[model samples]
Target: MVTVNLGMLHYVIDHVYGAFMHRTKISPPFFSRGWGGSKLELLERLINQLFPDVEGQIWPPNLIQPMWKTVWESKNACLREGVFRTPCDEQLLNALPPESHYARVAFLTPKFVSPQNMACVVHLAGTGDHTFERRLRLGGPLLKENIATMVLESPFYGQRRPVLQRGAKLLCVSDLLLLGRATIEEARSLLHWLDSEAGFGKMGVCGLSMGQYILLLLLHF
Candidate 1:
């Protein structure tokens, strides 16, 4: 009899993925452009300024007011796809790629629930997640429990991916910082919209891998 260890299989798969991601001709390692001059400095300054505010009890004021429009919906209206502007402030907008200016989302809910009685969770993207499909599927099962899901399309991903960028590997370290900053701002604004505009009773956030870190940052404000 032969015994197979699943743990070893998992490591094998991970090794294969790592090789494809880092050693392939088509796939570029992250931060391929190295640390940029002005953008890197700007990111450092912003981080220093924001670090102190994270400890404060008061949440930061919402700056983005996204006007959402339904792009697609199931025939029964139980699920829908929507999009809106990323709600990036002027300073952040200037630093982002033109293609990443808008944000996309997928909203899932049960048909009979009212917004006031339901809970909604905003799902952030992981390192390589470029679409709402995976997150939406993960949240779909909760519809029966009256919990809705909103999957956000991170900047530098999905329809927002920059033309020059390849896959999920960011071109520069500053781009990673920018992506994180933009995602946090957008998620916070979306939460505000869910509470004040959409009138959801309870709100929360969830993510996977890299997204988990972003979720933690969001909790600070």
Candidate 2:
């Protein structure tokens, strides 16, 4: 019927699959910064209308910071081995900007920081897989540039295991899609917090494979 490569699979995962899963019917604000600018803007506008009160909130204080001791250790391993398990704290598992409000949203914080750079570029991994060697190769330049980085375990991948490991038993992709919306909302909450607490303003997003595809959809519709 249809030929599928990693690239194609990623596209379906980000757009078709992701959309079906994240069916909230909220419109996003439209703007031109990258691609699909208009559609994402419309969707953002819709989200804002639906959730007007979901304003930017402050990040949790050190005391309230969601414990990620396990996540922290796993992140260390990701530094060493590329991919790490998802943190148990599901509350922290969302993307910033909530897609509800058209706030200045940015994803991923660079491992490195450089004042000379005005723009931050991010990389998104596919299938929640990476090798320590790959991280070393890919992460260095981004770090040098001080680009922000974020690692998301897509519904069935990475730290998104608890929900996905059920394997065709409990929930299918459709079920996971609902979870995906929650993840996006969570991400938005985190983004708002970062904006208020970390002082990171609007920046660009560069998603590899599925992430890129998602970014494209974000740009278009």
For each candidate, give its TM-score against the true structure: 0.86, 0.40
Cα lDDT tens digits, model 1, 66-127, are: 55566556643466666677776687788889998888777887676689988999999998
Tens-digit lDDT string for candidate 2 (55-122): 34334312112223222223212231122222213333342222211211213334343323424333
Give lDDT: candidate 1, residue 58.
Answer: 45
What is the Cα-based lDDT of residue 150 in candidate 2?
A: 41
lDDT score, candidate 1, position 13:
97
The model with the greatest lDDT is: 1
Query: Over 4 Å off in model 2, which ranges?
Result: 1-125, 128-137, 163-171, 217-221
**Stretches of candidate 1 exceeding 4 Å from the true structure:** 1-4, 20-26, 38-43, 49-52, 55-60, 63-77
Residue 11 deviation, candidate 2, in Å? 19
Please give the RMSD to the true structure for each candidate, in Å.
2.9, 13.1
